[model samples]
Target: MSQPTVPPLPQIFNFLQLAAQNPTQYGGNAADAPELTRILQEIRDLSIPNGAQHSAQGLEPYQSIARANNPTWNARPDLRPKISKFRIVKHTHWGKAYWSPVDLLGLFFSRLEPAPLGATVRTFFLPMTALFGRWAFQLVGHYAGMQSCMWKIQDNGPAQFFLGASIVGYDADIPTCGNWRRVIQKARYSLLPNESLFLRDWSFANSPHGPIHPKDDYPLGNCAELYPYLHLLRGVDESNKNVYGIALKKKGVRSPSYNDTLQGSVWQNVQWPCVKCRELIHIQEGVLANFAPYAGSKGAPP
Candidate 1:
């Protein structure tokens, strides 16, 4: 016997129309459930033709907007969404550093062939996208005062160094930023008065690991550790060499996250010591409890 064939989305759309008009006559949730299934299957059945005129180059712009409207689908699992490919900045000239989720969708749909969608699919796509926009807007609301996530300014040695010497897990208790700052300041000033540092507090959200990129590193312990690190990096400007911004967050907390270390730029022309001890100075593998002890870190380099 042959398998039964699945009907197209038009059939599903018609079915929903009947059920909505007479829910009591049909069944309530059960009646609507199949419609939902049909919509999902229809969505999955839709495909981007090979060599489709993709709006974004490597699949990020295309993937993000499509996935936002329809959750149960993905264009490619093993790839990161290349937002740069969309060029909303270059094309639209919307100067915000990040794209609003709505703008992302707008950029995407504008590039696609405007084939009429099945009624249910169209219904699902539009309202669902609106909800996604609202959600993203709410998430970014916290970033009002701070234009972007905390960023590392420089990695100048003395005042600025890598906190990657450490790793703290969620299970440990940590000190406040003030205390960590005092410790690093004492250590930095013990060497020199003016110093600039990037503390871990300004780096990661304290998630114990790096996401998107597979690197195991931490910056500094707290915001307090920032001044001296920055002071030192600036202090050694003539001799130091290396400049890059590294933003990070803490390892374990849920919100208002923590930091690992500060990352910033190297002096424009200075050369860094390739042989400097990568002995895991400021940050290293340890419980969160060990962070305070490493505060001054005078007797031993982390």
Candidate 2:
């Protein structure tokens, strides 16, 4: 007697469809419950070539628009050298200067494709300080608050820094604030040669302050609320090197969506240091602390 043959992918999908239609014909285990089986079949069907064809057809218009407006819509793989040579700037505040252990761990764990539930849970518990620092950097440092250390990318070049507006969409005029209206408008407009665009899906209603409209009127002025970490766009080739290409908008008469509601600046292609640089920074920090003059001593470096 011959051994039973394993089914091909299409055949497997057909079997799932049949099992979903008639659950009793299968083992009827909990995994093959009617609802679960139906969902699995639906997913399988969507993965087929025909389903993909339909999806592509539906997205054709959007793709055309994106290509026309965004230079990076179908950008060739960036072949720039990985930023291995870099220095970390020491900040007065440690939290502001370096990513916390939890923040770094969370970022690492998130890159695990098809991560397990336990790993996801652990990643979620990481502190919000990293996000807070990002927000503060945008609101305080970029606006009218204290200046802080920014990362250097190449030798003797201007410091590359992260700005929230670069990650979250913002009005061309309000450089630091994130607004859905401006995001939508930019999606439709043609991007300038220097502008680089990225699309991110956001749900303002799901934020801690509860459901709110982008145009809601507040008594004291509508200040954006702080949100938890999602994901940062890193270089595809150098996953460890956090960097984005900067997009600068041209000066023009303001549109309604581009109203200057806030005072701040935006930057693009911001690069954060790699693990090795971070470790060296920690060591440097230790040395600085140890060699520092005694507190309350005269003529000590500030």
Candidate 3:
């Protein structure tokens, strides 16, 4: 079945007067007709997922990692798990993008309560906190996605250097079961944390947890976003060396040095981070986020 056509945005809305045919409608034409039409088309394209859509995807609720593993919010019934597992189609395939200034402005109004889930149960989250700036991307025992960057300063520094994160978790309140695929198109700043080896070892690789073949190490292994900021995800110890107490790297992840070995886009699946890897990454990042202190190599405010 086809989605119904969304009504185009009217030109000359309010006092803005975008694309006026007469030129006298609002003193002078503000924007071109093509541009106004494009504006409407953008809104028409925003495919924000409904709650059922989210549930069907089997997006995890954060109860697995919340304080004392508490059930934060419970729906009366878990939407019967949809047989078609989740996959990362392109943003255009999903038709999810902001339309106009209204959508941009609406970003501020949305609330994405930032929490560390890259390690476990923060269900797919990206918060508006990215806009406020300077807060750490707190990763605990689980990895939950959020709008955070590598803060290179501000432990006590008078000035903060890192630029701000883009608007995250804006369109919806992505519950614990929402927001994990980590390959958000508009939000590149968001990190992709799914790097479990068994995830990539599907077709050509062995799964007893051994060195992954090149074919099996594609998605999170080549991740461009997380490679640079993983230190932020893994906090520092008192002595300051990258502490890898969570899981054995070779057993769990694909490669140790993705920075030098990175070839192409991170998680390059048509829909990125396969279902197996998605679940694993969430669990892995969930555990990794819980470590105390920033990573030993954790930049003081990079």
Candidate 4:
């Protein structure tokens, strides 16, 4: 069935104003416009998730990266799994840009308490600990769809970025179940503690016991490698602001390198010492995708 027409926001807004003033003039907008009215009611009934709104520098360093750097500067694609069970469709196919802002905002507010599955879970879990400003696209106009980027984090993980896709419309019946199913089905299992991998092999790729990494600076290989994933859902970005800011100040994540003389968007592109062997691995997205069983086993002369 086609989606019922949503009354013009202005009309709805006016109805709300009337109801608020006398509350008896129209018997409340809810009875007049149940669907649109349901939204307002839901918003009133919603609550923010615990710890979902905390802002600590240590919790959300990614916002800093966004403040200092641009997301579109050096975007890349992911290449592992070599086969995508999932497809990236333009947002127009789903809806129109008309409903983008309000829908995204509502979704963000609605999911604050218990984050919705898939992107909702990923976006909120980061709190204020992300090292990349990948979630900045949340503020763009409705022409863009929020692509949920997945990441295989080592010690710390940052929010993913978004593509310039437009949001032409909105869906009241968000396929919560189907979305979660597909999300988990094509999921890239993470590397074990300190065990990062590039995942060239399919067998090892599915294992959940590995540390995942970015594939490259452009064209991310897996959903995790793609920065645009941050835009998957609308409000996921704003929710992080308040909490991330608080944590940043409370924890003080300003390392001298964060303010390094290096002038570029990839400064947060850091490599960590292996906890097991202490070997300094160049931890860009490529290293994560090119991981081999042993040091010399990778990219052999075939």
Question: Each model's number of backbone clashes?
Answer: 61, 4, 46, 67
Q: Tens digits of per-residue lDDT for model 4 on 1-302?
A: 11112234445445443444443343322333333343333322221111111122332221111011122222312321232222222112122211123232333222222222332211332221222112112222122222221222222333332222112222111221112222222221221212233343222233232433332111112222122222232222333222110011111122222222122211222222122111111222123222221221123222
For each candidate, C-alpha RMSD in Å?
Answer: 24.4, 23.8, 18.9, 21.8
Q: lDDT of each prediction vs. the true structure?
A: 0.23, 0.24, 0.25, 0.24
Q: What is candidate 3's lDDT per residue for 24-98, written digit by digit as tens?
A: 342333334344444433332321223222222334331111011113223332531211112232222112333
Q: After superposing candidate 1, which stretches have Cα over 4 Å from the reference?
A: 1-85, 88-236, 239-249, 252-293, 296-302
lDDT of 2 by residue, 1-302 (tens): 01112334456456555655655443343443554443433333233234331124523321101111232322422411211111111211212221111122122122211212232111211111123223222221221111112111333432233221221211222222113233333221211111111221212232223344545321111111100011222222232242221112211111112221122121111123222222222322322221111211222122
Question: How well does model 3 score by local distance difference test?
Answer: 0.25
> Which run of 10 residues does model 1 get worst, by summed lDDT?
142-151
Steric clash count of candidate 3? 46
Question: For model 4, how many clashes?
Answer: 67
Q: Whose TM-score is higher: candidate 3's or candidate 4's?
A: 3
Query: TM-scores, in order shown?
Result: 0.16, 0.18, 0.20, 0.19
Q: Write the per-residue lDDT of candidate 1 for residues 1-302, one digit (tens) a residue.
A: 01112234355335444544444443234444443343323222222221122233444323212211122123432232321112221112222111222222222221121212331211222222222222222322211110101012233311211211111111111121112222222232232221222332222322223221322222222222232133223443433333221211221111222122221111111121111111111232212222222222222211
